[model samples]
Target chain A: MAGQPHYREAHPLVFVMTHWVNLICMIMLAFSGFYIHFPFFPGFMGVARGMHFFAMYVIIINLTFRIVAAFTVKTATDLGSREVDTDIKNWLPQEKNKHQFFETVKYYLFLRKEGVISAKYGSLQKMAYLATIPLTYLQAYTGFAIYGPTMKGGFFAAGTTLVGGPMNMRIIHYFIMWVFIVFTMIHAYLANIYNFNPSKIIFAWKETDH
Target chain B: MAQEAHGAIYDLLAVRGVSRRDFLKYCSYIAATLGLSEAAAPQIAAALEKGAKLKPALWLNGGSCTGCTESMAQVDTPDVATIVLELLSFNYFETIMAAAGKQAEDNIAETIKEGNFILVYEGSVMTGQDGNTLIVGNKEDGSPKKGTEILAEAATAAQAVISVGACAVDGGWVAAYPNPAGAMGVQAFLDKEGIATPVVNIPCCPMNPEWVVAMVVQWLLVADDDPAVFLEKTALLTKTYKDGITGADVTLNYPEYVVGSTIHDNCPRRGHFENGEFVSEFGSAEEAMGYCLYKVGCKGPQTFTQCPVTRWNRSVSWCVNSGAPCIGCGGLNWVDNNAPFFKRLSSMQMGGSLGNVQPGSVAAVVGGVAAAALVAHGLGMKAAGRIGDGPPMETAKKYDRKRMAKGGDK
Candidate 1:
């Protein structure tokens, strides 16, 4: 088997930085969020809360920037190719990804020996990636609904009341955090399963030639 | 005549050994609790002066433990006796009415017929077994009248209804998970039956006596014996519940001042929280120093109440002050929300045979399973020759290739 080519057009330098910010913020948010949820250790409630809020804000801002950059940045439309298109086109489903959805699933399940020809992201990948946007916002909304000071606001109060009360809101927030954690786990494992090339390009921005 | 009536109230207070000055001080305290200014104290006093035409009240018990009644007895300043004897004609209070059996049932019936009266309902509205779970008294033919039947009749005739305690607000402990008696809140049951009588909910495991008194005083001074006016004067927050029976939105009203702020925000040990000083263990040096109970499963942050300020049992001490974490008894579905009582988060109901499980344990099991599955999937990928530079990539789908061959173009 020949080594597949990697290109800088797949992930721009700006997106690399944003991805780094997202990764770091998610890690911190999860850690501090867990701590605040159940102060497993002593003497860190204030610090944990401060870190959780700080990370939450940073991740939200980073996510917004990434969404904006998706329209502006250019990235490769296909794996192992330098041919490019607007990043949003690749991030979202395109003509090339139409019928290859089940084929990609089949390939991963070991039913198919060859990889399916598709866009940079498979249909499942695109769907999962798209879900994070709303999931993140929902987490933040539920967070605000449970927070003591912000909870009094009519908007947050409506959400709290809709879900019955703050307890349910808190539970929703906790469950969503787990969703992120599991997503991260599967994402990291699958991204690195074949090789660390994707990681290298995304994290280190190192391009490789076949 | 008004002056003579006013003198009679003072005379009644004198007979009860409560000095005029003490009574005035109590009025001021109540005004303050109602979020009213000191000027409202005189208005409250004036309302009490006209207490000769005592507001007819019936303190009814449903599926209760009589904790709210016990809490009422703990009212310090004006004293429970003064409230019952002079300020309000409590026609049917089971705990202290000194009348029972047929006499007590007759009192409730007579009070309902009078039309202008306040109904102070305590405990969960037992709706289980067609409301047979709680039989309060005997009917006309010596048959039993369900507690719900009695409440519906009384609530319909009452001028205003006060749902005192967590039970009356949302069925408290009895309505916790796997609720045996099918207990529900008074407002919810009323909404289901299409009863339009407005409920004022004062939610705590045992109703706070100070809050009850403040609401009663607010009714007298501000509402001026009018239920609609009472709703207008006090800033009431309404919560909409979809009626289970009708599937229509049922709006329940609660006082804003009571549920506006969290116990954490008003907590006395908040300074210690900011300082990151916490009591990890009960009865430790940190506990003695009055550190925050956040680390010890204090539900104060999520619980909305003024318990920290109001202080239970005549301002002596509260739960956190007594070194017990807040169980969030002031919240809706409180027992289910804050139980395990000593943990930061409540155990989620997994339903069926699995029953209740902790949130942390669930998260851990999920994360672990996901990780394990990923590892197995990774190994499968490797076995299928999909690792390294990855599997062989096909140029096009078979259908796409067939289409291209047929066109013989591009």
Candidate 2:
């Protein structure tokens, strides 16, 4: 802790805002989505549906904004360094990240005693983060297929038919939510495992230097 | 001659105690149901009355319980008996026809040889045990002519095939999971056999007879007995589905108005649904209040059928009106897609003894397992002393190690 350095350059102000939006939207969407699936209590369906749809749209927009910001925004390319580059460079596979995927897995599993030296994000982290984009869009697709208004469109209807029926489409949507839940659980644990420096910088925009 | 024939129709209607006005009114009703203009009513009347020779027809039955025939019989306007007996020359009708045994068998043969007859098929096409599941008549060798054999012969020669009821459309409940009988819809069978006759599908548990009547009249008046014209002139929605049995693509035609919207979209209790007033249980006070059946497993939201507009039993009362949740019999593969009928979602048939399982239960189990695994992994991380400040960091990258092995820093 005495020798370590952390700075605001790791996660700039705008990226922190988008991260908060993502966190808040995901929580609201998951809870509201569960309620819409089965209204355990009365009189909340209307509100639950409204909240679910609102969060869905917000999350999609926030994700798109985050992706676009990656190209324009600049951030620290390496930990403990103030040198900056467009954020998209850090997201791309860097020379330092080569062959680090299995090493990171080994370190997490306790099979290796030391963590892997890598770029801004380890290989596993980058892949998981990138996968969320398509998975979120797929969730939207499945949602629209079961929805009454948009379901009749040729594009959605064809997807519904391809999945066999509306019921099957609903089941797939339910399963994808579980995938997100699992991903979030692992993400939160890993991000905070090595103390809360990542969270402090991402959430509170604070810097820690010895 | 045409005038004499037209006069004979009114005289026949008078004999049946149906006034000329009532007859014309019935034609107008059919015209409206077919989405035709008011002027088309008189044209329909002319086409129906100028029946010097009635269009030949054969009403065939396959793997069925005769429910559709019973439903058709209950039609009060013009009555199905009059339509079958007088309007169309139904040379062979297994139900409500006097001809039977050899005489009835001969009628089918004669119609096939004659050609140009409309084939109204009821029930699933049985191809089980290599087509021995349903036997219609004996072959010339005194063995047995399968229902599949009879349907193939009749469908091949017919100008158009009208597949009446959900059973004839997509095998109904007969083709449900673990379908031991190997039943399938007529169109799928025809596709497998390479029969080129265009089929008009009227799907429901027993089907609304009005749709059948509208199709028949449309065929006579608008299509001029041409199958191609029938498809072109009618407002149809065509969808190509893979045959469940043979895995072959089969295109089916449904009347757009019939399968156009979900039953819930036109349900009388839709106000209750939007208002969140639901009938939670059968025989409850809420049920008496006629609330929406969505909570009680009404498949109306997913089922596409105009049941609310065209009520069953001659527009008396449909499934929801009678306080029963819709079982979604109008949809394709309805039983498998909407079974465990009282629940919101369908149960998945988990083959063998596993039986039907709810989708929610499976999701709950998977989520539970995932949570438990995450907790155990957390405990493992704590035991490994990797929870605080994490593991030691590698000073050099894995690639740097190779560079160092090749002698010193890169």
Candidate 3:
């Protein structure tokens, strides 16, 4: 038993709700945002705009709630660890996930096999996740800064002036959306690669107990 | 048949020395032109009656060539439509006003101070050189008066500001790229200064007089005793495209009904567009056939304005109908974004190092590069023995263990 690598199980309820929220929010945001960007049909403009704005507010609220919950919620840390950890800490790095960037790269490049695996996340994964938090906030900020009433306000006015004009700012916002799209694509593909377990836990909220 | 109405028709005909019958006939024709029902003739006749006593309107030339105001003089049909101006009073007009600078300025100031006049503003608002770009009249020292200062004073006490021509709406060609002279349209400039007074925009290179007439009629329809009240109501409808200085919002807040659809929607030559008939070259047989200008880069598809229905030059011809492709002058930042008039789209302004890249082209190129890079990386992964086997486990673990037992924390 001492020789066995530590493995931890996540708190089923909080994780279940969070996973459902994230999946639903991301889907709703993408769908409604696209509809607002261009009305594919005529009758749906008002509806699409309503949905887009509603989704935006909902996603923002959900994200805020999720971030706060991360501190309180205990989730799995290591694949083989019995020690529980704060989900945010696990999502970020502990003392362990450092200088592993190139090593992970080398492993991906097939330079090394049986790469070091310790915590719940590898360095690369942690970074990609952390990076998304800021990028998401930035995308939202840019979006708000281009919004009609918001753009005229002093808060957004500074960003608009800095970027030259609203058009340029809007372009930045658009390009950043593409970044999120690519990120979501890569993320979904990577998460589902090993098995369907992650998808079950995250999307379907079906916890895998071993 | 040509003339014969009451005081309204008589006054209009009187301006050009036409007889009473001729005046009434002209009134009927004008009523028809304005798209009014024939039954509205007596009502129109009554309005003209009240209109004939009005003072001459002032047409002020700012940093403009007064082309639009000049075009206003060209409004035809025995010039009776113009006699409609006799309903109100015009104390001064730059091109034809008998008064000189000081006299014109004084009279306009008096009229505006009384708060009973139509202020017609022409040309771009010059903010370059601290308003030194356009000097309307000289100071006592014989130096020119700043355009901005004069504009502020003239605008503050006016009943209404009618911004004529593209330049007055935005900097126009004069305010093109780099906007060295800091030329901006009347409304945009006014917004910057926090002047909330309403402005009616009549757009075009020089602008059409019919639009002015329509606006005048619209104003007449909703004329109010308090200028401020009228201004407040019109300002609601007079919203400007906030970012015309940049081509961010392509369409300004033009009347939705007028610019709601593209010229492509209402073009007389739309049959050719669907038929795939195109004008390959200028003055070609296809051109004579009035083929669609889409292939030739007609901006009609992207442009929104009532040019097709409104036409130009006495409704005889317009851009596409005249064999000229649409240049999208009605678009915000029209000149900067729509010029290189011969081309379908604005050309990229090339500079050193970076190659000239159009917006659409840049998007395509960047997309292509990322796709190519992804494919190449995928091939590299396969070649490196990483495709079949997952990443190395020992190294990844070693890395994780090292992080878990960290030394220095930031």
Largest TM-score belongs to which candidate? 1
> How accurate locally, in lDDT, is each candidate?
0.83, 0.84, 0.63
Pairs of residues at least 3 apart in sequence or in different chains that clash in candidate 2 = none
User: What are the chain A TM-scores of the candidates, in order?
Assistant: 0.95, 0.95, 0.86
True contacts kept of each: 0.70, 0.48, 0.21
Return whichever of 1 and 2 wins on TM-score.
1
TM-score of chain B of 2: 0.93
Candidate 3 or 1, higher DockQ: 1
Give me candidate 2's interface root-mean-square deviation. Answer: 3.1
Q: What is the lDDT of residue B66 in candidate 1?
A: 95
Question: Residue A204 of candidate 3: its Cα lDDT?
Answer: 60
Candidate 3 lDDT over residue span B1-410, tens digit each: 22243555474576578766555565565455456666655655655665555634566777787777777776556555466654556676778777886888787667767775677788888888887877777766787788887677667766677788788877777787778888888777766766766676767777766566655654564353345655444323222344544333222234333444566678898776645566767878878878777556676654556778777765778878768888776655677666566654455556667644444465456656666655676666556544433333453356445666795354
Residue ranges of candidate 3 with Cα displaced over 4 Å: A1-210, B1-5, B14-41, B75-77, B85-88, B98-115, B192-196, B228-261, B271-288, B340-356, B375-379, B390-392, B395-399, B403-410
* Alpha-carbon lDDT of model 3: 0.63
Docking quality (DockQ) for each candidate: 0.60, 0.49, 0.13
Error of 3 at B314 (Å): 1.8
TM-score ranking of the models: 1, 2, 3
Residue range B1-410, candidate 2, lDDT tens digits: 22344566776777777866677777878878888887787888887875526888999999888999888775456653264236778898888899989989999999999898999999999998999999988977899999999999999999999999999998999998877889999999999999999999999989888888888888878898788888888899876667689987777899988988889889999887766678878899989999888877899888889899888776789999999999999988989989889998898888779788888898788878877877887788788776766656778876678778999764
Instruction: Give per-model CA RMSD.
Output: 2.8, 2.9, 8.6
Give the TM-score of each candidate. 0.94, 0.92, 0.64
